[model samples]
Target: MINAKEAFLKASTELKENGIENSTYEVREIFKELLKLNPFDIDFAQKELSQSQEDLLNDAVNRRKMHEPLQYILKKWEFMSLDFNVRSGVLIPRQDTETLVECALEVVKQNNFTQCADLCTGSGCIGISLCHYSKGLFTQGYDISDAAIELATENAFLNSCDRFIAKKHDVLLSAIGKYDIIVSNPPYIKTQVISSLQSEVKDYEPHLALDGGESGYEFYKAIIPLWKNALNKGGYMCFECGEGQAEEIVKLFEVNGFSQIRTFKDYNKIDRVISAKLL
Candidate 1:
């Protein structure tokens, strides 16, 4: 008997009580996803939700109340204004990482680079975005998780980035082929501090994409040396880092024979991306 707007308002209140920051946005998204209709389309004020749709709404609200991510619930997200498929077990693309992509684009354009290796590519956001922003750029993305690889591949196809390829490989174990650029947003959250993060991250997001080992630099330490062989002379390397970790990652790039090391902050002004060039 409840109307659509009434149901949404109730769900939003519940979400607010649960401390979800994007409660209002989540409600609109859920309506679009579950009901095949946008809440704001055609003035939902007078439209009553069907019984089945109401049940679906309740389920979505409860899931969010339990700290599940809205992206996972919607099964889609946007990166750099491009749509990407999202699901559990694969890392969701964060807007902060867009700073890394933007910075890398400058290097790619400066060198007229046409090929890139995206290590630890989750959902192929970085690699796919590069190919999108620059025509003729080919991209290869690698990840250890089968789910991540599969999702990344699907995203490449979804975005019509035919030159993008995703493979299953751990950056810590081996290196990709030489490319004009290499980018990664590897797990950088410290092993110990992961548990203290927000429930949306600690409880819902994949730990394999967040844990950075004892010093929050295990992947960086392991991949820098290994990736050295895959980077061509004068090629660029870039990374998305946790707050305050860019300095250490720049030092790692320096240790591995990279120069012109620089860092870029996200909109939040947190040190988020670091870049360097191979000497």
Candidate 2:
């Protein structure tokens, strides 16, 4: 048995020694997730974790030391203030992608768009969030990975998004259905640069969801024109872009006859999201 405070400090030290940033925060989360203890509460010191709980905490920390993503270890993450189920085979939802969702929501509300197509949907975070927030919106999400489809289906149910549908599909092949809004946060990392990414990403995250081909714009290139006709006239297409890649994506939208292209920056002021409308 171990007291909550002791377990927290031990985990924090181990993670810090392993060069993990935000070690304290991660420890707090681990305690909450595994042991169901809130380290910040006044009674936290009075709580003791059973031996089994301690073992679970230790195992989680050990996984972190191996450079596994904390989100994957926890099997859950938050995007757009909504909880999402995530695991090894599925790409974890990210805060950066929230910018894309926010832009899509605005388009949905402004035009009262009822249907949304989420291409390359990983955890279905983008589509699920849209359906969660919009009463009339129905979203169809497609991904190449069966794991993603399964998890996304579970997540939509978990989040009470009855209108959200997850389907197994390769977005590179062809467009499927018509929609008033289409959004994607597809693979945008350059193939050569992916090897140099942090171990938590390069070693643990799925490469099928990371490799964006040589120019890091392969998905955007294929998605823009392929899905253009699938988008209703005056409908919107939103994308989460990599750093310095937004400009090129905007050009692709223009060449595909999209108009009113707009770019939004993430918290870091990086060009992170681009939204364009079918002409």
Candidate 3:
């Protein structure tokens, strides 16, 4: 019944009233997703939404008003410029994580690495993107959450990266097999700090993917030592760290006797990714 422009204004107003920053962008994304209308382009002005389409848009807006992440509501998000499926149980892919992917790709290219193990591979973003970008690269993605595993596998197939395999495995355990490189964007939020994160993260995102234990280094502490055994001699380990966590993570790699340690920053210049090579 309502024209697309009116729907866009109404949704944007409602979302802005709910304190959602980037309300306009969110509204445009919702409109494009639910109504198949490009709110930014010329065609969006002449478009109209059917009754069911309007209902769907309203439902999406209501969900966003509750502080649910827009990515989860859309059930898909872009990472490394590739589409990935996401939902309630899996942690949504984020731009910061792309730094880890880039560093891993660099390592893979420089070292001619082909076998990779991706830990906490939510939505298969990092591993799949590696395989997507680097030909002949094969990745085995591991996660503890069944939902994460399912979505990761689905994302692998969606990206046409059949070389990426998703499996349910706790990273705290011993390594399964040796690989040319190991990469991860493991959960590193301090447990107490998690509760203080924005509602979109604390309420909607899975704690299993956010709670990094009391020190926020639980996964890193475990994976660095345990999974390093799974890496071939001279293999590499690349990881995405929390804002202030990379320095200490580098120390961990040092203590583990990893050589050629290096850190990379995200667009925000935060120390986001760290890499090291086994001697």
Candidate 4:
């Protein structure tokens, strides 16, 4: 018979004890999710939770207490101010990737690109956000994981991105269609270091979306030259990379005959994105 305030406090305390940095925020989000209330629905936070809601909240809280990602527990994530359906097998859309999206947006708009392709497009956040912002631009997003492809497709519809298409594909193996813009937030974590990551990433997030081979540049190495065949001359290629990786990634693009290479920082001032043109 727990009330809303009690439930919030209990969940907050549990998360805090487990070292969750944003316990209060997570508790409110979890409460909102379990109650099917809006994020600002403070009134719901004042009411008593029914038995079923309480059970569901406890189960969700338990998952978070076990280091499950809050987004996964909630089954949705926000990116580019757009909602995306996320699940266990697919990588969650993150705010950091929005840096890449911002850069891609600029390139696409400046070039008035009509076609774009997203490789390793988990959840279709990049491609869908691009399409949502620029209606009528044709975009295709590819993911190696079928689960990710499905999730991306659902997000495309949920966000009314009619021009976005998703398909199961291994970016490491083959290149897709040519385009005026290409973007990706491919796996960038070093393979050997994945196990040392936070439990939320190491245990919960799919490894196929995290492991980037011995040097964390395996995907870039594979895509830089091969994907060139999929790009129009003077078209843009953008990427979201790990911290301190943008410089090296620029060199990779240079070797692949890309120029006008530039990097951008995120809100935290981390060098998180790189954009280049194939000339």
- TM-score to native of every candidate shown: 0.97, 0.98, 0.98, 0.96
Q: Write the per-residue lDDT of candidate 3 for residues 14-123, one digit (tens) a residue.
A: 99999998999998888777677787787877888899989889999999999999999898999999999889988989999989999999999998988999999988
Strongest candidate by lDDT = 2
**Candidate 3: segments with Cα more than 4 A from true spot:** none
- Could you give candidate 2's per-residue lDDT for residues 14-120 as a string of tens digits? 99999999999998888888777888899988888899889889999999999899999888998898989889988889888989988999999999999999998
Error of 2 at 190 (Å): 0.4
Can you list the residue pairs that collide in candidate 4?
none
Would you list the rank order by lDDT, best first? 2, 3, 1, 4
Please give the range of 10 consecutive residues that has the lowest summed lDDT in model 2: 29-38
* Model 2 regions more than 4 Å off: none
- Point out where model 4 deviates above 4 Å: 37-46
User: Which residue pairs clash within candidate 3?
Assistant: none
The CA lDDT of each predicted structure is 0.90, 0.92, 0.92, 0.88
Q: Candidate 1's residue-wise lDDT over 220-254, tens digit each?
A: 89988888788888888898999889888888988
Residue 45 miss distance in model 4 (angstroms): 6.6
- Over 4 Å off, model 1: none
